[model samples]
Target: MLTVKRLDIADARILIKGASEKANEIGVPMCIAITDESGNLIAFERMDGGKVSSAFVAQDKAFTAAAARKATHEYNAANVPGNLAFGIHTEVGGKLSTVGGGLPVVVDGDVVGGIGLSSGTPQQDMDCAQAGIDYFLQNRG
Candidate 1:
């Protein structure tokens, strides 16, 4: 038999709270999402004044990060013309986002889940998502 770690509600909430706080600090409304190891939605939030389009984009970013076990921006960096992973956005049922702001939630060197943020500049989104990822890594021992 094999045992595995998963993202529970408590951990999910921690991620969301951390992400939200970062977004608020930047004064940028955002859509935030967290997913389990399988890229299944664990929790989500669209901040007031956040763009509606960001809701799905945020979730997709989280899915891409969780499924790939790497930051979504890494995909963008690799998928440029003549790059190794070109046309990857067309794969994965179009769920892979080439933009920034998605990060894997790693615990003990294992990707337990992912968090993504949208509805802000790419840098802002990355910063907020990174905040959540950092908090989880710090608290989830």
Candidate 2:
């Protein structure tokens, strides 16, 4: 038998709340996505004025983070031309992202989920995603 840990709906809400707060603070409405360890969607939010096209992008980012167990930015770094890892974003039906807005949610050194944000510059999105993970860590009791 195998045991697995994953995020639930309440956890997803916490991630969204934290990410949205950061987005509001940064004056960038965003689309936030939370996914289970297996990259299954748990919850999603599109803040007011968030770009409609970003909805799916945020989800894909989260999927890449959770399923790959690494931040999307890390992939971006390794996905440059002539690198063996290049073109990885073309995998998983083009769902894998090399963008900077995706982060794996880790608890006790275990990746339990992921958070992703879009509708802003990549740096802003990355900040919001980190904020979500910070909030989850501080409030997951």
Candidate 3:
């Protein structure tokens, strides 16, 4: 049987810090969340000026990414047009956001968690997420 490694609180904190730094650099507050492979929340943070509502949105995005084992944006884009699964997000308790800022957190090339960021423009959100991922990869080993 194949075994998988999961992200821990430390990992989540690292990602969150990276995301927060990026958001601060861009002068945008952000809400960031991390979830396990089963879509359970691991850790989360909301910047001082972040939208209060974005906290839930970040959790939803992380849950959707981890549960689907794919970046939410990719799922959204791939399932558009003739794909019935495109609506799956709606059925998943409406906890999914097909936006660009949610990404699966992979370890050993396998998705073990997810990271989600909100409270910025879509592109800025994505950039913050990317910064977090980059930090994880750089410091993980």
Q: Which candidate is the best by lDDT?
A: 2
Error of 3 at 42 (Å): 0.7
Q: What is the lDDT of residue 140 in candidate 2?
A: 79
Compared with the true structure, what per-residue lDDT tens digits does model 3 show for residues 53-132? Answer: 88988898888888888787787786686786667667577887787788888887888899999999878888998899
Misplaced by over 4 Å in model 1 are: none
Per-candidate RMSD, Å: 1.2, 0.6, 1.6
State the lDDT at 31 in candidate 3.
95
Give the residue spans of candidate 3 off by over 4 A. 79-81
Model 1 residue-pair collision total:
0
Report, for every candidate in turn, its global Cα lDDT versus the true structure: 0.90, 0.95, 0.86
Q: TM-score: which candidate is best?
A: 2
What TM-scores do the predictions have?
0.95, 0.98, 0.91
Residue by residue across 1-141, what tens digits does model 2's lDDT show? 988889989999999999999999999999999999999899999999999989999999999999999999999999999999999999999999999999999988889998999999999999999999999888876
TM-score, cand. 3: 0.91
lDDT of 3 at 140: 70
RMSD of 3: 1.6
How good is model 1 by TM-score? Answer: 0.95
